[model samples]
Target: MFDFVRRHNRILQFILLLLIVPSFVVFGIQGYNKYSEGRNHVARVDGQDISQSDWDAAHRNQVERMRAQMPGVDVKMFDTPEIRQRVLEDLVRERVVFAAARDLHLSPTEERLDRLFKTDPQFAGLRNPDGSVRKELLAAQGMNSALFAQRLSQDLAMRQVLSAIGLSAFAPESVARAAVDAFYQRREIRVQRFDAREQLGRVQVGDADLQAYYDDPRNAARFQAPESVTMEYLVLDLPAVERGISVPEDDLRKYYGENASRYEQPQERRASHILVKAEAGGPADARARAKARAEALLAEVKKNPAGFADLARKNSDDPGSAAKGGDLDWFSRGAMVKSFEEAVFALKKGEISGVVESDFGYHVIQLTDVRGGERRGFESVRAEIEAEVRKSLAQKRFAETAEQFTNLVEQEDSLKPVAERLHLTLRRVEGFTRGFQPKEAKAEDAAVLASPKLAELVFQSETLAGKHNSQATEIGASQMVAVHVSAHQPARKQALADVREAVKAAVTQARAAQAARTEGEARLAQWKARAPDAASLPAAVTLSRARSQDLPKALVDAVLKAPAEKLPAWVGVDLGGDGYAVVMIEKVLPADVADTGPIDKVRQQYAAMWAGAESEAYLAALRKRYKVEITGKAKAAEEPAGAASK
Candidate 1:
């Protein structure tokens, strides 16, 4: 066989090529095309496509970040199409700014990056005393020092691009003054109000008017009942699971024993120290001098323990505590540097210690007080232990239970079967609408209904038409809900007989308001033709945007907007159901220039407005320059939670 194969090597190679090339052509090209189609580009920036998967990942990251920050908040509140669109826009903006930075050679220098990390308060937790990156802190955020530095540098460069436009904004004194003067300009006006309530007795509305009002197409929505459903749902949440879980007394005790330290309050020490100014890693001479100075303070404290505070106040280099007699107050383990903690813990109450060296400097320590370091007994924390154990068990069991719950809900036609199988409560709610919160709903039910996902599932065509169990929807972390809509009521206009009283009230109010407006207009005309005596009108009051003088906004607006160039101007304002007003503009007054504070504030506001506008314009220009295109069709705007169901 070996001899034969060696003889046919060339022919075998040709045969292998024929087979391999065909497979590559047949399968590999199709696989490549499928991969390309899977990308599903939704946006493009600087000719770089942003695929749907990328957008989803970015939005998921943002949602998770927000969830971590505010665990108690409902994730559904921010997980909307609008919020996702904003995230995509932000991603596009970031890409555009990054491209601009690269093109303009605006990369931040190493020195600037280091300076920012050390000086910026936001990064204080991520820096060591010597201004080095805290690798552990970065690791907690799922990034290494290198990655953090890269991100920080990029952010700084992008900020520089926007800051250039923002900082260049300036509002000249003249421009600022004109705007401020116009905004604050006051008008002295006398208003005569025709209260609708007073005119209600005079206005007449009968059955005919009520019927007409109810029959009007424009008023149909007012008499219509919103679409609603009566649903029975099964909630499989961590809390519900925990409620059913019962931890044995022995198990609780075992958990308590295993985690005894958690129930034990750590010992806290209150101490004062005279800190000498010198870095531990400073020159040998400086460190030595700091140690000597601390030793001298320690000796003085030993000689006169009562006068230690006075000496600390006078000589301590720690400015934070220098004025307060060098008091560091109460601190537990892991709160202070290792050397300082060790030194403080070693001391007896009211005992003074020799010089201790730490990252900041050397310190002469004195322990003034000690507290805590107590372990709670079994009976004292038994309830707490049981709750903890139950919650832990529920968390572990939730995934499996959730799977079963989902499967059972889908396999079965109703939620009752799943509820029974999972030993969960089958709760029922009547008149549950898509976005409406029942006035008498419990807190738990309200929170459940607040989930747009759950509402959407309940109103889905299949679920509504078939009256079957909806899919298990995740309303929150570790919270799944499956609802069965038992009864659905479509929206319909109420019969005129059913809504007669409401229609009658509406007609009466409309007639009264109109009557008031008519009288006000007639009075305004008469007052304009011949100026009424000052005694007949209400006392003149100054009005401005800043000060409404207890007048209705409509009246104030009408008074201020009337031909104020001519004094004693007359204007009529309809105040809706409240009534109407005839305002007499007595005089026009310029802004108070005497108050420099207001003028300065106006200038600052103007500058801020100008800067914001400039920044937005610049961003628009950048978008144009990058040829940014968003191809994703925006989802229809969703009604907010607790809004009208219709």
Candidate 2:
């Protein structure tokens, strides 16, 4: 075959090309086109497009990290339009900063990286006793040591772009002091309040007034009832699955025996060591010097055994334990460097070990104490074993059962059938309007009801029209809910006759507030024309932003904003529904400057605010420089009524 191919090399090459080119044309080109068609670009930074798939993957990673950090929190809270938008913004910001850093040639140095790992508190968990990066910790975050180092270097470079602006921010002391004084300035004032409720009996409303108030266009939404539905929902979750599972006695005992080591408490050793620090990868001469130091400490300890702790406290190089006589409190087998652990475990209590070398350095170890290393009896851990076995079985079965549940929900018209099949209770919620939150719902039920997706599905036109079951929706990890609308009522305006009492009450309150304001204004004009008797005014009280004296915010604002160039200036304040107030300004007092602590705090706060503003402005400039653009619409997540704006 070789001889034949060699003789016809050109012919063979032509044949190969004929076969390869056609395959590439048929699959490679078409497949590439299909893939490109599906990749919808949601954003772009520095002319590099970020597709929808990329945004989705980033959002998923972010949600998973949050879920890991707070397992008990509702997943729906993290998987929202607003949170997704934030993720996209973060992605764009990261790209923009990276571009800026790259253009500015802001790469971090090796020494800087080393110092950051050793000194930064945030990286403490990711460092070893030898002051080296922990590969295992990096692995847990799905990165190798090299990749982690690269990412850290990139992050440091990016931070320099913003840190230059943020860290350099300074607030002039004089300006800060003036602003703080104005913010907390005190005013002594006399207030005469006209309570609206006092005028309610005097202001009368008839049927005509009530009807007119109810028919007003401005008050339409106030009287209109929201569309609501009576829904029956079936929840399939890990807990529900676990509840239905039963672990046999024999299985429980088998599991306990198979995993007996898990029930055993590993032995712990309390040891003290005087360490002579030396990096494993350092010069050989340095390692030898460290060994000599350890040997010298060992000799001193052996000569005066009772004075070992005093010697350790004086000579130990380990900062964490040096002050405490070099005591490394009780730790398990895998907690220390292998060589150090071996030396400590070999020594008897109160015995000292010869100089032992490890990655960190040389150590003179003294075994202090030993404890634990006991296996719990079977009977004592039987209940725990059974619970574990049941949970494991339930978790394994959840995916399969979830598939069946989803199918059953789609096939059936009601949730009852699926609920019975899955051994789940068919729960009903009456008058469940869109965005309705049950005040006293169980945690699980509240999580299900809180899902915006489930609410959207429930109120769909088809689901409402046919009163059928909605498709199963995954509201959380291993949690699915299928809802059925048993009955629904579309939104409609309430009749005037039906809401007569409510309208009457509203009309009376409005008229009463107006009457109170009118009377208060008249009193203010009279008082301003001529100085009223001090006895006629209410008791004088000091008011400031810090101390409102339990007065309404509007009233306090009016008093403080009144011109104080002339003493005893009068100001009229409209308190709306509360009523009105006539304020007589007696005096203005500046904020106390004697306390340096508060003044320093105000200065620091002003600096931080300035830094934040500067950082935001810098980031905006970087975004413009990079030509970052968000192509997709990203709406803010819906907030509940009375929720503070983001």
| lDDT: worst 10-residue window of model 1 | 19-28
lDDT of 2 by residue, 1-646 (tens): 4554455444323322222221221112123234324456898877766677767766776765566556686776786778888888887777677678889999899899889879977665557799997665444334576655666676677778899998998888898888778877889899999999999989988888887888889998878877787878888998899999998888888888888899998999999989899998999999999899889889989999888789888998888998999899999999988899899989899999999998888899999999998999989998888788888999999999999998999999888888888899999998877677889899878878877767777777667765568888787789988888878777779888778888888899999999999999999999899979887888999888888899999998888887899988999999998789899998899875543247678889888988999999989998998899899656655543212210
lDDT of 2: 0.80
Model 1 lDDT per residue over 1-646, tens place: 4554455444333322222221221112223234324466888878776777767766766665566556677776777788889978877777677678778888789998889889977666456799897665445445577766666666567778889989888888899998888877888888889988888888889888888888788998899887788888888899888887898888888988999999888899999999998975689998888888888888889899999899999999999998989999999999999999999999999999988888999899889999999999999999988888889999999999898888999999988778777788888888777676767778987788777777777777677765578888898889999988888777678788888888988999999999998899999889889998988888888788888878787777777667777777888899999888988888888876643247667789889988999999999999999999999754745644323334
Clashes of each: 0, 0
TM-score: model 1 vs. ground truth? 0.64
- Each prediction's TM-score versus the true structure: 0.64, 0.63
Overall lDDT per candidate, in order of appearance: 0.79, 0.80
Best by lDDT: 2
